[model samples]
Target: MNSDFLKYQAQTTPHPLAMEISYANGSYIYDSNNKAYLDFVAGISATPLGHNHPKVISAIKKQLDKYMHVMVYGEYIQKPAVELTKLLAKNLPSSLEKTYLVNSGTEAIEGALKLAKRATGRSEVISANKAYHGNTMGSMSIMGFEERKQAFRPLLPNVKFISFNNESDLKHITKKTACVILETIQGGAGFIVPSNNYLQKVQKRCNEVGALFILDEIQPGIGRTGKLFGFENYNCIPDILVTGKGLGGGMPIGAFTASSKLMDLLQDNPKLGHITTFGGHPVIAASALATLKEVTESNLMQEALEKEQLFRKLLVHPLITEIRGKGLMLAIITPSSDTANSLILKCQEAGLILFWLLFEPKAVRITPPLTISNDEIIKGCEIIIDLLDEIQQQ
Candidate 1:
């Protein structure tokens, strides 16, 4: 099976953590060998309620029995999509009321960028350095890191980058700018959190210049950061809000929200401006709606903060330099890239699942499922600490 996987599956990386999965439940995944590996990465923060969650699975099953994709998005009055969007609007600020559902985060980013350009009649877009929006042409164009994007050059033009959290760089966002997109908490950049009201200041500058303020909450939103949206924690609201990952529970989905007046622009200027066939597929939307309901109705959001404290309190070691981020969205910064690699690999071998952040070589990702228990938290942290101690001794 391993050989077949390597030969048949096109991989993103040369070496993949090829775990042959038998099944997963709650906070643990069972490999084909029946080895129970404690899940700490949560499929890179996609499975907030954990794998095969009852509610999400039931929603998917129920929707499958009823219907799937009836028609392209916006043409059909699908219940799942309608309910999901309405719930999202109910939770978000009044300005961000209407949502455009899409196939993935990158596609949502593309739509948001197009909308910004349509609304402002401007071409320039600004992003933060070390920021990662997505991998599509437009999103990649605004990706702050040049190394990953340079190969895919000749991307969208007139896109600029500014140093994140650097107040002086706000000068770059001029009246010609269409939108300034940033992650509510920069995920790939070692889970860096905005400080000193930096996001609020950015919004202020974008308002002053008439450019839309867009926040990509793909990694930090959806109850992962002790709030429905990470922007709520920072006392800032964006003109355009993008979300994915945990919003669909373990399913694949993405959405971009803005004012009805702004989103309506996609209709008139050019009829059928943006269209997607399976953007709001019924099964996926059902799963997302269930996930959102569980996250909002349950105490999961508040418990995320408590779980973060437990992780911090337990994961104390000399080799660990710092833990950056808030709530379940966290990265353990090791002293060196080699140490980070060693820690993740060793933890995997020791029946614990840990991963690494993109662009941040020295950072080990620890974004586990929000439903992970306290005992599971202690157990995972012990494995991490034990591995760190072993690495330190070497």
Candidate 2:
């Protein structure tokens, strides 16, 4: 199977962590040989509820019994999609009352960009440096890291970048800007959190310039950052809020939300401005609804903060320079890129899963599931600390 996987599957990287899994439950994924590995990355922050969560699985089963993809998004009123959007609206700020569901975060990003252009009648978009929206052309075009995007040049034009958390950069946003997009908590840029009213000042500037402020909460949303959305912690409410990753609970989904007044613009002026055949498929929506319900209704959000404290308390060593980010959305910065790589690969071999940030080679991602228990947190941190200790000894 491993050989077949490599032979048939087109991979994103030359070497993949080809773990042939049998099954996963709670916080552990078992290999084909039944070797259990503690899950620390939560499927890259997409499985906030952990592996094969009962509530999410049960919701999928129930939805499967009813129906699957009956129609494309926005064409038919599907119950799962409608309920999911309504619940999201109830949890979100009043202005963000309408949602357009898509298949992935990048797709939602594309849709949001389109909405911004349509609503404002402008095409210029301002993004943050080191920002990562997605792999799609529109999302990629706004990406700040030019090295990866250089191959995909001639992307969406009129997109410019500014240094994140730099207040003076607000001058770059003017009336001609259609929208200014930013990751509420910059994910790929080493989990950098907005500092010193940076987000608020950006929003204020956008307001003054008549530009729509869009927050890409793809990695920081769905209660991963101790709030329903990361922007809630930063005191900045975006004109358009984009979310995905952990929102689907394990299924594939993405959505962008705005006020009904702003969202309704897509309906007319050209009818069907953005369309997806399976954006809000019933099964995925059911899983997402169940996940969102569990996240908000339970103590998981608060637990995320408490767990973060536990991680900080335990993960201390000479080789570990600093920990960046808030709540579960965190990155441990090592003294060197080699140390970071050694810790990740070594930990995986020791039955602990770890990952790296997209652009920060010296940073190790620690975005575990919100449902991960105290025991799990302590165990994972201990492993990380032990590895760092070993690295220090060497």
Our tally of clashes for model 2 stands at 0
User: Can you give the lDDT of residue 357 in candidate 2?
Assistant: 93
TM-score of 2: 0.99
Give candidate 2 regions above 4 Å deviation. Answer: none
Q: What is the TM-score of each candidate against the true structure?
A: 0.99, 0.99
lDDT of 2 by residue, 79-158 (tens): 99999999999999899999999999999999999999999999999998999999989899998999999997889889
Superposed by TM-score, candidate 2 places the C-alpha of residue 127 at a distance from the truth, in angstroms, of 0.4
List model 1 lDDT by residue over 1-394, tens digit each. 9999999989999999999999999999999999999999998889999998998999999999998877888987999999999999999889999999998898999999999999999999999899899998889998989999888889998989898899999999999999999999999999989999999999999999999999999999899999999999997899999998888898888999999999999998698888899998899999999999999999999999999999999988999899999999999999999999999999999999999899999999999999999999999899999889899989
lDDT (CA) per prediction: 0.93, 0.94
Q: What does each candidate score in C-alpha RMSD? A: 0.7, 0.7
